[model samples]
Target: MDLNQILAQLETANDEEIKSLLQQYNRENSHTFSFEKRKKACAKLCQSVLTVLGRQVQPSCQKTCLETLRILSRDKSVLAPVATRKGILGEDTQSEEEERVVVEALKCLCNVVYNSPAAQQVSVDVQLANGLCASLRNAREWHHEVGLFTLRLLFLLSALIPDLRGSLRREWRAVRLLREVLEHTLDVRWVGPYEAARPDPQALPMPAEDNERAMEVLKALFNLTLSDPGGEDDHQFRLIAALLRHLLMLKTETEEKQRKHTGDKSIQNRF
Candidate 1:
């Protein structure tokens, strides 16, 4: 299909057509389509799709557009928009859907970082973290799965790059935003009526395992920021103290809940 047809398909097409358009876009222009190029195109098309969907009477088209962005986010190219000065992924200049795409793209980049070393090599962790911080608060209506995924990304990121942690320590907003989300994860309100609302916390179902992983990531980030002997004299002692306190509380809460449940079962058995 021609470019106009492709763009048209992207805006109005069903799932299959959207996928096909992406595939065709990639296949035909794979070599020439640099990450920046794809990002620009995605940004432009994403804006158009959102504009069109926004006017529609139905919600499905808007949802489909969001879903398309979610899928496109898997490509590293798509995530680059967030890191740009224009803040396409950020709340600074973009519309809601545009920002949503950027958030999804960041999550995708984090997954790529975990799964592939090459992608991480191409990114500067501090820049990516800055982008992520910008997205977190703005996406209050974000899907819970996206929230959970973003949290996991934060965990992995804080672990993978120590330098980023140092930058984050100095960057109060980034640190505060992350702490807020960490607090949210601990909130009962975060748990909803259905299984879907809760973040699986566990890569497995066992809470301890998930918490353990979370601890590892946090510890890594902390060490990067506060544990470097040559780093800084201040070493962010206050921030580290707060993080340590939070970690201990989380552990204590988890243990207490498990113990209470186990005690209840034992009492029932004795009866």
Candidate 2:
């Protein structure tokens, strides 16, 4: 469809239809759209919506459309301008509306990594880390949530990048940094009507669930390296070996616990 037709649809279509159309447009036309075209389209579409709807309530359908823009960002054609958008970059002048776009963009980026074929083909783990690092480095105080969400998603995507030499060092450090930041932001509580807003200090905490997820990412990275066993990448091999040792230690503890639990169950049965 022509640009006019597409823009018209974006303005008036039902939420589901709008989402579908946006995705289709992003996927099919991304390669073909000129740089100027993609830039203008993104800026215009995002601006128009923010003007009309504001940011308080993000409709599910609009969420999908925003995600489609994120998918589009995978293309250099689309990514450069969006990343460099006056609003997305410098923190000094970032408004809440701009921050909303950044957050929505990250949500889309996460969805792409977790659910899209594009992520599989695009080395999402590395690229996602880079994107989030940039966001965290650039975020303003009001947009701290955006940085937090990006960090959370990076923590998840770490599961998919295979371990490489010196990989553990960087990966673990990143997780540690994220945990520290989450801890620093720790005012969210689980009581009362704010239950949904409660922070899982465990997953985002040191010596807690965050450590577990970090271990998971480490294991996944190690597995990826092991799966392709070739002439050894010495540093990777050493890192993997270290992680394996740590895992074995945990496994021993797990087995002992299971044995104890089983024995407790047998005693109950006799009673």
The number of clashing residue pairs in model 2 is 1
* Off by more than 4 A, model 2: 1-97, 123-126, 134-144, 164-168, 187-271
For model 1, how does the per-residue alpha-carbon lDDT over 80-108 read when each residue is reduced to its tens digit?
Answer: 43333332233222323444543544444
Considering only N, C-alpha and C atoms within 3 Å, which residue pairs clash in candidate 2?
163-221
**Residue 23 local lDDT, model 2:** 67
Model 2 lDDT, residue 149, Cα: 57
Name the 10 consecutive residues with the lowest summed lDDT in model 1. Answer: 188-197
Give the Cα-based TM-score of candidate 2 against the true structure.
Answer: 0.36
Highest TM-score model number? 1
lDDT of 1 at 9: 66
